[model samples]
Target: MAYDLEEQEKLEALKAWWERYGTLATAVVVVVALAVAGWSGWRAYQGYRANQAMGYFEALEDAARGVNGPGGADAATRIKAASDTLRSEYAGTAYASRGVLVAAQALEEKKDYAGAQRELEWLVARKDQSTLQPVARLRLAGLLLDQKQYDQALAQLNNPPAAFAALFADRRGDILAAQGKRDDARAAWQSALAAMPANAALKQIIQLKLDALSGA
Candidate 1:
């Protein structure tokens, strides 16, 4: 009789403890399960987005290369359409920037300077978190320079990243030289030469420019 009574008391205590903590324990389990499911769903969605972006990018490449036909007006139209889609829908993806750059190059090759400028300007305007921003700006500046839009080109070359400092200076020299600012051009080229790596192939070219400037 004593052992039976003691076992009953222990059982009652266990029941009381569970009644107090069971709800909290269940809630924790539910929260953990939801978090895991949410994470998995997010990963799947990202993969889907990436795949879609890749498809659009491939189409843009094909159009740019004239893979579908002789690559005339039809190809240009296709390239524009595909690039527009990528920029509008997948601007967050690396492929979007790449598509825009490719489209710009193709348009420039076709002597569609206005179209190329528009595409490059769009990319530069976004100022998104893309590493390609620098490239876009540089290309835009080059296009402006070719058009003899000196002030606009200089504006785009301002405050370039350190990695591109030498290139920017070199281009600036070209612009200044075109404007007949000989001393300024020489200084800019000297800066470019100083920033270049010792074994850089461009170093020799930059040195030649400097020497030519001195002779002039």
Candidate 2:
């Protein structure tokens, strides 16, 4: 009789403890389960997006490569189509930025300078890809220089990133020289020479340009 009574008391204690805490325990379990499920879903979505973006990038490259031959106009059209797909579906991906750059290069090769400018300008205005901005600006400045848009080219070189300082100064020299600002051009060339990497092969070319300026 004593053993039976003790067993009954233990069973009752367990029931009371469960009644007090069962709902809280159930809620914690549900929260943990949902968190784990959500994390897995997010990872899966990222993988899908990466794979899809890669496919679009591959198509873009194929189109860009095709622009070298006889049917180059058709290839350019295809490049535009692929670029549009990348921008529309994978704008957040690096592939989107790269596709636009590739399209710009193709347009430039085909002498469609206006089209190239539009593509490069779009990249410059996109705030999400901060790293590509300087490159786009540099290419755009070069285009402007080629078109004799000297002031516009200079404006793009203003306050460039440190790594591109030498290139920017070199381009500035070219623009100033074209405008007959000989003294400023010479100074800009000197700054470019000073900023350039010591071991760069282009240093020899820059030196030649500097010598020419001095002779002029």
Candidate 3:
């Protein structure tokens, strides 16, 4: 009977210790678990938003590319509106970058070079190391070339990403040709031809340019 009483006293002491620290331990565990869950949920929401924005931009591009009628003014206007909406809602997303390209294309077709230039400039400012950036630079250089800004066009073609090297070389050739630098133009065309795939028709075009330069 005495041993039993001693054991009960030890149990009571343990209970008191637990009562002193149990609430704090539980609160710490709950906070940590909730923090993990909240972080995961936030990441999921960001990914979902990014995907939704991409889908909407894809739809807008499809609409822009589809042929409507002889006069495409209405279609062009719709494309511009869609692109503007994307820029406003998803400005920080890759979809917004894509929308800039679409809007610039439409504006170019409409002969609104100023508007197209604005879109291209916006893209240039925001362009990163992603696929969109090189493509945007290529298009922007083309616009600059149209304005006879040879040096600016060449600057854009320089140090392009690996995926865009051939196209960049071809653009450089075009710029050089415009400047009457026949030898440099030929060299650029040859570089483009060397980089281009054997099956691509663009290689043949570059070869022809090289031959013509040699002939002259």
Candidate 4:
């Protein structure tokens, strides 16, 4: 009987404690649940936006294909329109960056370097995944190189991540070669060769650069 009484007393104590703090505990649990729900909802919204962007891009491609005008400037305009839609409707998605790349390439093909640079600038401003950012930076650097903006191009290529470092170095060498800095270009090419994989095709290309630079 005594043992039974001790167990009953402990149960009563537990009940009282729960009664005193139960409301606060319930409120905390509810808040946590709501927080999780909100995060999930935001992710869902982002995913939906990405899907919408893909649809818009497909439409834009179709528009480009059917576009008509002298010099394909009409196609450039269509691509720009699609890019604008992506910026307005899905700016937070990876598709937005992709749209920027496509529009920039189209503009570049039309000899609209300035317009292409502007799109690249917008992409640089966005928060993108590591892989995408490096690719964008590389392409932007190439555009700068085409404009003979040597300093800007070199700056962009100087600090790429490991995945892009070799290509960046090779581009830097190309820029140096264009600027008449043969020795510096050779050194850069050597660095590129060291960084690049030892595939036969790549090795042959690097050897050619070395031979050309050395011969010159």
Candidate 5:
């Protein structure tokens, strides 16, 4: 009888504690469960988007290689369509930037300068940070140089990333040389040559440019 009384008291105490805290404990568990599920759902959605973007990128590459057909115009159309889809729907993905670059190159090869420029401009205008922005800007500068838009081309070279510093300087030399600014071109080439690694093959090419400028 004494043992039975002790067990009954313990049960009463547990019931009182649950009555005081059970609702709070249950709410806490529910919140944590929901957060975990939401995070998992977000990760799964990102994976799905990445896979879809990859499929389109592959299609873009295949069309660029003329795998779908023989007609040049048709190939260009397909390439443009694929690239546009990636740019519009998967702009957050790395594949979108790469797709645009490939499309730009193909269009440029076909002498579709306007179309290529438009694609490049679209990439440049994106606010999202991307490693490929420098490359796109460099290419755009080159295109502008080809068109003899001297001032506009120079604008694109501002504040390049460190790894691209030498390339930017070299292209600056090209633009200045075209403008008949021999002294400025020489200085820019000298900067590029100094920035390059000793073993870089491009070092020789830059040095040759410098030598030719000096001789001139």
Candidate 6:
């Protein structure tokens, strides 16, 4: 009887514990299940989006290639449509950024500087697009320079990424030269030449600029 009483008391304690905590335990299980389902759904949606964005990108490329062709206007329209889709529906993807670059190049090649500048500025404003920011910065600076917006161009070229250091220096030199800051231009050119790969064709071009400044 004593042994039976001990077992009964243990069973009662377990029952009380379950009565107090069963509802909370079930709620935790439900929450975990929903979280897992949500994660899976999110992943699937992202994959679908990436695939759709790629399709738009491919179309953009073909259209971009034709933007300088005989039917340039028609091609430009197609590129605009595809790029618009990427920008609006798939803005978070690499394809979206690449599409913007392609569209900008096409617009610039047609001498549409305002349109190109707008596209490049759009790319630059996307803080999430770290991979494409430097490219957009360089292109935007070039556009500004062509427009004689010297101050704006110089500001964009400031503290360029390491990969673009030489090109940035070269652009700065151009801007400084245009402003008639010969000494500063020469310094910038020298910096560009120093940063350039040895025996690169661009180095020769930079050297000529430096030589010109020497005579000035």
Best by lDDT, which number? 6
By lDDT, the better pick of 1 and 2 is 1
TM-score, per-candidate, Cα-based: 0.89, 0.86, 0.77, 0.78, 0.90, 0.84
- How does model 6 score by TM-score? 0.84
Q: Model 4 clash pairs? A: none
Report every candidate's CA lDDT: 0.88, 0.87, 0.82, 0.81, 0.89, 0.90
Candidate 6 lDDT over 14-107, as tens digits, reads: 8899899989999999999999999999999999999999999999899889888998998888888898889888998999999999999998
- Cα lDDT for residue 44, model 1? 100
Ranking by TM-score: 5, 1, 2, 6, 4, 3
lDDT of 5 by residue, 25-138 (tens): 999999999999999999999999999999999988887787334677888888899998999999999999999999888888777888889889988887684588888999
By summed lDDT, which 10 consecutive residues of candidate 6 come out lowest? Answer: 1-10
Among residues 3 or more apart in sequence or in different chains, the pairs in candidate 5 whose N, CA or C atoms overlap within 3 Å are: none
lDDT of 3 by residue, 118-204 (tens): 788777777462768788789988988898988987887778888889999999998899899998988888888888888998988
- For residue 1, model 3's alpha carbon misses the true position, in angstroms, by 14
Q: How close is candidate 3 to the true structure, as a TM-score?
A: 0.77
By TM-score, who's the top model here? 5
Instruction: Tell me how far the alpha carbon of residue 176 in candidate 4 is from the true structure, in angstroms, after superposition.
Output: 1.2
Ten residues in sequence with the least summed lDDT for candidate 2 = 1-10
Q: Candidate 4, which segments miss by more than 4 Å at Cα?
A: 1-18, 36-40, 63-71
Between candidates 4 and 6, name the one with more favorable lDDT. Answer: 6
Please give the clash total of every predicted structure, in order.
Answer: 0, 0, 0, 0, 0, 0
The residue-by-residue lDDT of candidate 4 on 10-119, one tens digit each, is 98998998999989999999999999999999999878777889988886666556444463766777788888888887887777787788777777777888988888
